[model samples]
Target: MMILGLVRWMQPVHGYDVRRELLSWGADKWANVQPGSIYHALRKLTEEGLIRAVATEQVGARPARTTYEVTPVGEDEFQTLLRGFWWGLSEPLDPFSAAFGFLPALPRSEAAAALRNRANLLRANVASMRASLESDWIRNSKPVHVGWMFELWAARAEAELSWCEQVADRVESGVSYLPAELENAEGWSAWREGGAPLDADPE
Candidate 1:
């Protein structure tokens, strides 16, 4: 999606230039761009008749480079990709699932505190990233709606904060995520027999 928009914004650009522009706009840090993927996408786009080479030029210190422009078909393809990107929604893919699965070991009060702390951290991050997202670098960029990406990010951050608060409340109220077996003695021996450890301390 970015490549399409970028090529449309700056036609007659090389893969390296695309990479450089993306880096300048901090796409690697914020978006799903990989520096190495630009050339590959360019090749694929050319093969798919989305973009066509227009000229070759040699700068003083840089190697000769082939420039590309979006074809008319590429404009249509770009809109397709852009619309698909904007309309698509996905569930959160958090990396903390594994740690959360083992979270029963902590006492309820401790867990609540930790969750609250996480909520605060996420709030701070949301605030900071929002400031940057609203900065000229993003707002002045193409599409005028680029800031919408960060707006969605902020919304997710707000959702996460709410989830953290809810989870903290649940932990504090003793309505934890622990399974019934972990909360009862009958579950222990059976769980042990199933080769899972009964070392879980549902404090």
Candidate 2:
């Protein structure tokens, strides 16, 4: 979305220049966009006829560079992608949710261990994110919205880290989960015996 909008707004920018602009704008920290992905997106958008190469220029010893300009179709697609992401209350479909749903397949001890490991990793990541936000590079270079984005990601990481600790404690303490039946046991007994998952009812 940012790529398309940038092309449209900037008008006939080279791939390298676009990426430099994006970096200056701190899209990596804010939009999670990598520099390589921006080039890929430009090539893909060109192939899709959303953006077109307008000119190729060779300046001095530098190799020929292609400058891209947005087409009418690109403008329409940009608007669609932009409008799709709105500020409103909506459930984000996270892949973590799926893994969490399937967590019962593992033994309680294994699950607790895994959750504790995850908590440790999240703690490290949250600390790194907070540090980056505080660093002069991000604080000075990024826009106010980019700062908000970092704050949001850091907050989410912290929350998830806390949840991991809580869930691990619950599993370790045996505070949650239903009474077990002979049909299902933790780890791979239920799967090996061709039954439902450990938490699932045979009925």
Candidate 3:
């Protein structure tokens, strides 16, 4: 969604150009957009009348290039999506992290499965981020600041990997899970102050 908005802002960008821009901005670290996904989104948006492709123009013996421009509706949708992105960032708990945070309340089998899934994802992401950091494009850069950005990305990936490892350890140990109702109750107080379940199931 955010990539689509950025493409709309930089009207007439080619697929390769969009891919390069996303890499340059470290979008891979923060979002899941890829070249194939970008192409899909572009086609869908165009078909929906959110964007229109300008006629391909030739500069030399090379093949012509298709450029896209956003319609007014696209502009409106972009703004709305951008605002929602910002709002989500303002929250303290990221959705993925929050799931791990509440693992103690989930069924033991389900929690273990979720932890394993998250670990696998983190492993893949960390490997990819490390590869990017070591790539010639990053290493051969003359700008000290840009080179440091790749280092930063690697560091962030490592942090996520560490968190995943910790979660996996707890899950493998068969740690007991507390009911959501008792999660926050003090040991003695919970014994004396019994009440209804903390969370009622929705019908």
Candidate 4:
């Protein structure tokens, strides 16, 4: 959808320019639009009759560049995909959630230290995103909506950073590491076998 939208917005754009534009928007980081994948996607879209190659030219001593424009079908598809995403409630999966499920796998001290490390990383990421929002390129070259993307990212990172810090503090303070019965291998085996369900009533 991103590639189609970009092609529609910047018709007669070359693959190189497409890649550069997406990079400028930080799409590679947030949208998973890798630099190497843009050309492949362009080819695929062309093959699917969604985007058409309008021109191919070779600058002296440079590889031939193929320029593309979105087909009417591509425009329709792009709009559909965009609308679906806009109206959807999908959230990206967080690796930390999976790791946290097995928190007791590590020593309590180590687990707390790991979460603290994550908090530090989140802090750095938030700082970088905020700094990018204030950069001249973002402020001058891109449209106002582009800045909103960075704002959204910065906001999410900030929220995660706060949560990470609070959780790290709790872990460090040994809050609910586990019930005493569930701190050993036998307990874990029982839990896994459903001999002991975490949410089961004591009665």
Candidate 5:
């Protein structure tokens, strides 16, 4: 959907330009836009008849580059995807959420320390985002909505940081999870020793 939208917005654009534009917009960081997959995605979209190659240019000694423009079908699909995402509130899956389910497997001190480390990382990310949003280039050259994207990302990081800190504090000060006996079972001891992952449904 993102690639289709970008192609529609910047018609007659090359895959290199599209990839660069997405990276410039920090889409790779926030969205599922992988730099390596952009070219493949363009080819796939062309194959699917959603985008058509309008021109191919070759500079001597360099690979040929094809320019693309979205089709009417692509435009309609992009609009449908955009509207669906806007009207929905689906949350991205976080690995932390899955790990949190087995929180009792770790000692309280280790869990608290890990959460603190995560909080620190989030703090750094938030600071970097704020710095970018305040940069002269962002303010003068980028669209106003780009700043809003940074704000949204920073706000989410801040919220998660707060939650991490709160959880760390509670864990450090003692919060009930599983019964002590179960937590210290032979299986849990093996997991800690072997660093084994839990099954979706452990017997």
Candidate 6:
């Protein structure tokens, strides 16, 4: 997604230039963009007719580079992806976590079943991330910054799995709903206290 964004930002950029910009953005610290994946995405986009490749001549010993430009189709797709990314970040809680938090709104048996299902899904995701983090492709030749990002993602996945287990335990123990009084007045008060202040009346 970042690569696509970069391509859109710099209309005629080559693969090497894209790699350089990734480093410039401190992507190594905050993002994971393997060399192969970068090349692969560019190739895939070209093949899909989403981007056009133009050959540029070099002056010195450097070989000519193939610069890429996003097509109209690519621009529309990029905007769609960007909107989804922003929406996911702005949500107060992840969908998976939110389901667990509001399990009381569901029937006792059904909620318990749903909690177990989500826990299994989370556990599988954690294991998959761990395996990817430990793979030779990621550990050996990949840059330290990129590897660190994988590690960070794996850590977050593990933490989420732990939370899922805790929720499961609560569900299994027959703790179904927050008390009506607590759900109403207390919950509303706590929510208002933590939220941003309301705007003053307009003069």
Q: Indicate the worst ten consecutive residues by lDDT in candidate 5.
A: 193-202
Query: Which should have the higher lDDT, number 1 or number 2?
Result: 2
Query: Global lDDT for candidate 4?
Result: 0.80
Error of 3 at 150 (Å): 7.9
Off by over 4 Å in 5: 59-62, 178-203
> Compared to the true structure, candidate 3 yields what TM-score?
0.49
TM-score of each: 0.72, 0.75, 0.49, 0.81, 0.80, 0.48
lDDT (10s digit) by residue, model 2, range 3-57: 8888887888888888987898778765778998998999999999999999999
Tell me which residue pairs clash in candidate 2.
none
- Model 6, position 139, has a per-residue lDDT of 64
The lDDT values for all models are 0.77, 0.79, 0.66, 0.80, 0.84, 0.68
> How well is each residue in 52-165 modelled by candidate 6, as lDDT tens digits?
897766869887778999999889889999999868765344576665554444555566666677667877876876786677756654345566766776787678667767
Report backbone clashes per prediction. 0, 0, 0, 0, 0, 0
RMSD of each: 4.8, 5.0, 7.8, 5.4, 4.7, 12.5
**True-structure lDDT of candidate 5:** 0.84
When sorted by TM-score, best at the front, the candidate numbers are 4, 5, 2, 1, 3, 6
Best by lDDT: 5
Q: Write the per-residue lDDT of candidate 3 for residues 94-129, one digit (tens) a residue.
A: 787765555545555566677677667767876776
Q: Model 4, residue 165: displacement in angstroms?
A: 1.9
| Pairs of colliding residues, candidate 1 | none
Model 1 weakest 10-residue run by lDDT: 189-198
> On a 0 to 1 TM-score scale, where does candidate 6 land against the true structure?
0.48
